[model samples]
Target: MTAGTKPVGTKTADAVVIGGGIMGASAAHFLARRGFGRVVLLEKGRLAGVSTGHSAAIVRTYYSNSITLELAKRALHMFENDRDLLGGDCGFRPIGFLLLIGERLRAAGEHILESERRHGLHVERLAVENVAELAPPLSLDGVSYGILEPRSGYADPTRTTENLVAAARPWGLEPRAGVAATGIRLHGNQAVAVETEDGTISTNVVVNAAGPWAGQVGAWLGLRYSLRWSRESDLLVEKPADFGELPVVSDPGLRVYLRPCGEDRIIAGLGAPKDIEPVDPDDCDPGLDPEMRERIERPLFERLPALSRARHLGGYASLYTITDDWHPIVGPEPGLEGYYAFFGGSGHGFKLGPPIGEALADVICGETPEIDLAPFRPGRFIDGEPLTSAWGEGNRG
Candidate 1:
């Protein structure tokens, strides 16, 4: 079931999932794994060919909320045991995750540490001296402290999505790459079939995980999702031979995050809480903007001075489908029977996707999930229950 092998012609299925990013791929995989029968995943492009592919792919459990913390914990387990749980290697790197706290964010950082400690997650509070020992390259000038997640690091985003789809192939999961879902057919408020460019798929259950296009997909059903789009960018710099290994680092003072891409490259991106550059998903530029280099590298250079001599290995931009609350909208829609909304990763979708998708399958099958997803329901925004974070409005959730 290689990508773009063929179109999925008209057929009947137990469930049809829209979008082939990590969310859709993971949902389709779990549904099929649960024996839901004849699950189909639709993608307008190849799997992980959009935002997921361009993700920083940081996998850490430093969340302020219980639900996200739990999901992130489970996601770490899945990536760690990818062969048994995810059906293949997901390129997980266990170099650890470090969050640098400045004097201004000290209180918020303490709150997050307390929350993680109370939830039984492995975390360490590091002083500036200890932080220097862990990451020698980091300059902790304005930093007050640091929180280290010893078991967290990152994984390959593209490989993860592809492996999920490949793993579910034997379980009756049909992945249709290059096939766009144009509309959803309903009967008396229940989804009956999904209309696509190649054909149609008749199914009782439909999951909208359509990333940036989720708004348009919901519009087909007369449902409106308040989603905004931003052009997020990341840059890669060639690592110097003498530069030693480094862990995934998030510096709040600089508003940037950096992680090792491979043995010879470092990937850096602007952190959340910055001004949003609104963009249309379809017409946005894929190449990184010229001005972004200074924004991303200035902080990166401050943290790792050795990179000053490193070569610019180019970069690219991608879309971040953001919700007003900066958290994802998941779970079943109240009025839309058999239809669920699973888009809006905001900024941290890569690590949470598989675990959330697994739990979503459990909910769809009428079984209690390991982690409760009620906090992420689609109606939370309307019901005035938007999840808040210690970091205020950002992807720090």
Candidate 2:
């Protein structure tokens, strides 16, 4: 063992969690709380130092499916009272999320409203005039309507993840950082051990919360996943005082969104194009492309004209493991018993982490999840059924 590292012994645990992002860290915390002792959390890099650190951290319940809406609602509740739920403040801000729709996405907005109602999530479809009322400076000349998720907002992903990690520490769960899992050792169709760069760990139940590297981890256990990777092109602009009060805004037609950070900075991201390369989750290069900036700035300038004077503080990239369906693949992989995988989050993993972590802990402990996970199973693809995209015509524009 190096320094304070736990010595390698034939230590057996009820569970071993891989990847210390929000997903893994939350999973470990929930597992320990649910009476699972000897839980171990392993991370290849520093905890919350990967995609979790680079996340835009927006939380919204706007969706065209009941499941996603419920997931978001539950997570929103947790984030709102994180001090009680996770034992500390998670720095949550309820700035609300405004989805501006064009004529093309009106139907999608309607569908999402129906689903939101079924899940008891309170949202409103605002008229163009009412949208202008929410943000006086926004130009609604070409906009159709707005889907206002009143209870939704944003948080600091890094701070939330670290807070969760600190909470897990007192629960008797040992978290090992800077340990990378290289492969898995199997015996007769069962995963017996996890091979890491530093050492080997013996465990039967492994939660592969590896985020972008989830596919590679699956392959180690002899399973195939049709997952692709992509990079999120984000820009953090330091806005003048006048432009800082806007709520988290999404213009689906323009394929871009912006959320306020602190009092003077805002984080922004452009929607993924069909032709963009599936990025390596571990390696991200953030650069400014003139065309991309032009496309991103069009709607931004129209909505918040004063932002034209904002200085670009450059950006960072986040790796997304995506499935053909935009919804994530959660639960145990098909043909791989005693192993669980959580990957293909696309970009929604951070907001979904808390609730999903609790559900995952319930699943591992042989309890029914608070939310039905059948829709998010990893085996959905084999049956030629994939979760349809919930983003409507509004987003398509």
lDDT (10s digit) by residue, model 2, range 52-134: 88888888887666666778889999998899776588888998889888887778778877788778888888999988888
**For candidate 1, what is the TM-score?**
0.96
Using TM-score as the measure, the top candidate is 1
Which regions of candidate 1 fall more than 4 Å away from where they truly are? 1-9
Q: Which runs of model 2 end up more than 4 angstroms from their true locations? A: 1-8, 272-277, 287-291, 392-397
lDDT of 2: 0.77
- Residue 50 displacement in candidate 1 (angstroms): 0.2
> Candidate 1, clashing residue pairs?
none
What is the C-alpha local distance difference test score of each model? 0.90, 0.77
- lDDT tens digits by residue: candidate 1, 1-397: 3321223565789999999999999999999999999999999989999999999899998888888988988998999999988879999999999999998888889998999888888999999999999888877889999999999999999999999999999999999999999988877777888888877777899999999999999999888999899999999999888787789999877888999998989999988565688999999899988898888988889888889889999999999999988888898887888899999999889889999999999999999999999999999988899898888876646
